[model samples]
Target chain A: MEEIRAEFSRIYDTYNGKIYRFIYLKVESREVAEDLASEVFLDAWKAFQKGQNPEPKIKNVQAYLYQIARNAVSDHHTSKKFKTVSVEGHMDIQDTGDPVEEQAAISIEIERVRGVLKTLKDEYQDLIIWKYLDELTYPEIAQITGKTEDTLRVNMHRAMQALKGRLEPGVTPEPVLGT
Target chain B: MREKDIIAKFTILKQIEPRQEWVRLTKQRIMGVPIHERFGFIDIVSYPSFFRISNLSYLVRKPAFALAAFILLLAGGVALQVTNQKLQNGLSLAEEEYQDTLASLELAQAQLQELRVAVEDNDTEKVSLAVKSFEERNAQASKDFVKLVENSSKKALQAGMKLVQLQKEKSQLERVLGTTLGEEKNEELENATKTLIEQELSDLENRTLTEEQQQLFAEAKAAYDDADYATALEKVWMLSQ
Candidate 1:
């Protein structure tokens, strides 16, 4: 019992901040992310209590958290009654990047992309956000979204082109992927 | 860079600042729970990673999760080592303090015995004015005994205070120092001065002496109080012999 407590304590000490940041970045809702993060650890604790070695089961608790977070967001979407509301009311877009000019330009570009993201279908948005925004590999996306990696790859490519075509004429954003 | 690569890197950079309040709330929420509560039969049944997320493409993509886990494990190892050292040092100091207290108590008892015996032996004329010397020594021993008792009690009280103080310090240090012993060791060193004081103070509480010494003190005190300077001088000389 003591050993388990020590183990969790060590895990918490190490990854608490990082996991929270990951969750926050995804849900963009402090309340929902906080609730889901607790659920994540509570689930971890339950696994530990059942005599499972967490180190083997969860390769990375942080990634696992992001996985949970994505589901939580989807769940929120499914469970809600209202329209898809952006959690951007409290978001300070200005704080997204470094103060350097290049970074500032990138930040503006990302915000522009995000603005365009809202126009895509929810599934397309999920793939684009997970691939480009969340930075998950195809497998991680497959794991989170229940999609095959091949399908995810094709969807991602199509999503990017669709997004690029939707960009106002002459913006001609560069290709997202190299051939 | 391709727009996709730019977007990917841009996303990562956007995440760097991370909403502080969100992170704080999440940490507070999940950090307290144990690790096992995280898994559920439902999660296993719904294991997206097993069926839904698997693909050959995953084999080709870089393994970010594996890298993150390795880094966290490394950090955890260093932290554990540092904390272990500090806890060991604290325990060692506590053991030393216990030993020092025992030694001081024994020394106090021994000196008290010698003073008592000197009083009992009525050898003043032969031994540099025995009665006056014995009386002076007896008074000094009594004062020392009182001081020993006072100092011991004081130290005991101080230890209690120290325990509270250390606990508070430990909690605070856990913040700035973190769980690793490396950060905490410096704080321990600073706090060590207090531990030494407690050690010196505790020794006065338990100075051990033989029954013979007790008898000598009792007899000498009785003789001295009764004003039997001659009889006291006799017992004093006998003990010395």
Candidate 2:
């Protein structure tokens, strides 16, 4: 029991934020996303406990959490638990010590891209969020979504093109990271 | 828009995160199971496994059947124990019987050895009488018959040599037994008669002989000097008697 607790604690710390962000992207409601995210972890913990002794129930824990999160969101939507709302949420504050003008300019660019990202279909949004924002590889996405890597690759390309078409002209983005 | 720009835009979602206090509480809620729930007997009875004893509730519901089942189990154990003891007793009895048979075999072998000694002595006496009879009949028997008397005659001569060395007695008998009716046989016969005379004289020491026995001893000495071994043997036996 202690061993499971220690291990589950470590898993919860590592992926809790990312899982919340993934749900938040789909639900677009911080409150509903938090509830669903908590439910996903609780369900995963119960599964881990009830697993066969000396052998685990889950193989890829991160993918399983994402899979559970996906189901939670799907079930929430099926049940019609919350209404959709549009609002300009606050941006994450960072201490990069940039000029006020530069910081404001980057924040505005991030908001414009986010707005256009919301315009895309849920399918396209999932590929972009998991691939770019969540930064998961195609194989990891495939495990969570139960799709082949080839299909995800083709769909990712299509999703990118669709995002590009929806994004406005002359939106000149900030310098890409790691490039 | 460029592909890089699109990816860069979506990357902003990385900053969107749940509240720290809410994440902390949620982790507590997921991990905070009660002690009783961890080891719940209800779960064990409900679980689909061998440990589920709920199906056996009918056994407890009937007292007489339960008592009968317990009595059967106890009787089976006692029967098994009794069978084990009987097997042990049979093994010990078989071991005792084996020891008795071995002892009986040894006693039989000892009795057989005594019978062998008695038969060999009886054969010596018979061969002695047969040799005397053959000389009285002028040696008419075949050579094969002489060979047959050999083992008994040799032992009889050794018995008559009272204090002679056993090797001397054996060599003298072997020499006579190996010869036929020839000069060598006569010489061996004379030598054997002398040995017999010496044994009779040794016996006569510290004893006063009657006049007749003294005359027989003198005659025996004379016959032995003349190489008349048969007469010498006859008078020697009379003196010995």
Candidate 3:
């Protein structure tokens, strides 16, 4: 039991930030995201403790954590609709030695992208966030989303296209995938 | 913007991080360390070997004593199993109560929406039906609230507040329809709504709200004053959860 606790402590330290960011983006409330993230880890610990003989061992812990986070977010939305607050002012974007005007432009662009992301379907939003923001590889996303890599690739292409359509109304995105 | 530009912007979201306090607190909780340990009982139970006999020579010299120790350990194990079973049952019951409260709130909201639409259309018959459904669900919710309080779940107060808000809306609806409905019908609805609201408010007033709950309640009131019923209801439900 002590060994298990040590291992879990290590896992929590390693993945807590990524898990929090994943949930924070979806809920857009610091309090709710923190609460949900705590629940996710607590649930994971309980599951680990309850495991007995013949229970399947978790192979990919990061993907497993992401899968748990995905379900938690899904359950949250099913229970109640959340009004996504703008992340622009709430975010703590570090200064990269850029000029003031350049930083302001970046903030504006971030806000615009957030607004457009909110308009997309939840599945597309999840895919885009996972692929772009978290930078999860296709197989990792596939494991979390329970979709084939091929399916995810197609979904990603369509999601990007849809996002382009929303961000720039008159411009059509070129198809990145060949027939 | 191109997909690459979007990705670059998305990268900014990674800057959001969990507070250091939360990370430390969560780890402590997962490790079963109480925030405040008034006694050493938890430590003894959590690490039983520390309290157990470690002297091999002492145990080897007395077989009967060893047998007695083994029997005592077996009995302790059984007792622990029974205690665990009771704890599991209690948690399961609490979860069921939480789900019931959520379902009742949801039903109440749907009924309220229907009442709003009916009132807007000025359909007396539809209004009456909506009111009847609302009253039935509201009464069930009240009963559930009482059960939850009896069960001693902290959520009972929040659910009771929601019931109070629902009753307030019912009173407003009654007042709006009073001029058109018969005096007898208006009086009946008014009396029922008033009694329910009074009961819930009395229950709420008896229990002091925590500072956090007080803040939420104040925010909910502000939202209500602004006529944002949805946000008000959301805050109240959040308090309940």
Instruction: Identify the candidate with maximal TM-score.
Output: 3
- Give the runs in model 3 whose Cα sits over 4 Å from its true position: A52-56, A80-112, A165-179, B34-241
What ranking emerges by lDDT with the best candidate at the front? 3, 2, 1
Q: Pick the winner on lDDT between candidates 1 and 2.
A: 2
lDDT (10s digit) by residue, model 2, range A1-179? 88889899999999998888877766655668778999999999989998837799899998999888888988987885465544335444232344334545665766667666656666666788888877889988898889899998988887776656456656543322110
Enumerate residue pairs that collide in model 2. Answer: none
**TM-score of each candidate structure, all chains considered together:** 0.37, 0.45, 0.46
Candidate 3: tens digits of C-alpha lDDT, residues B6-56: 666567665557655467768877777632242322234555563365754
RMSD of every candidate to native, in Å, equals 28.1, 49.3, 18.0
Tens digit of lDDT per residue, candidate 3, span A1-179? Answer: 66677778898999988898778767756667877899899988887666622553766778888888889888877775444433224443344444334555665665555556666677787887788767789998888878999998998888777665455633333423222
Chain A accuracy as TM-score for every candidate: 0.55, 0.79, 0.74
After the best TM-score superposition of candidate 1, give how far the Cα of residue B102 lies from its true spot, in angstroms: 45
Candidate 2 lDDT, B1-241, residue by residue in tens:
7998767657765756666546766986889855445332223334455323464465678876778656756875886797678667745644554444334334433433343343357665543443333222222211212222221232223232221222233234436444211111322233444655566556665579899888888887788778665566667666655
- How does residue A39 of candidate 3 score in lDDT? 86
Q: After superposition, how far is residue B13 of candidate 3 from its true place, in Å?
A: 1.8
Query: How big an interface RMSD has model 3?
Result: 14.6
Highest lDDT, which number?
3
Residue A136's lDDT within candidate 1 is 67
Which residue ranges in model 1 land beyond 4 Å of their true spot? Answer: A1-31, A48-64, A80-88, A92-110, A133-135, A167-179, B1-13, B21-25, B33-241
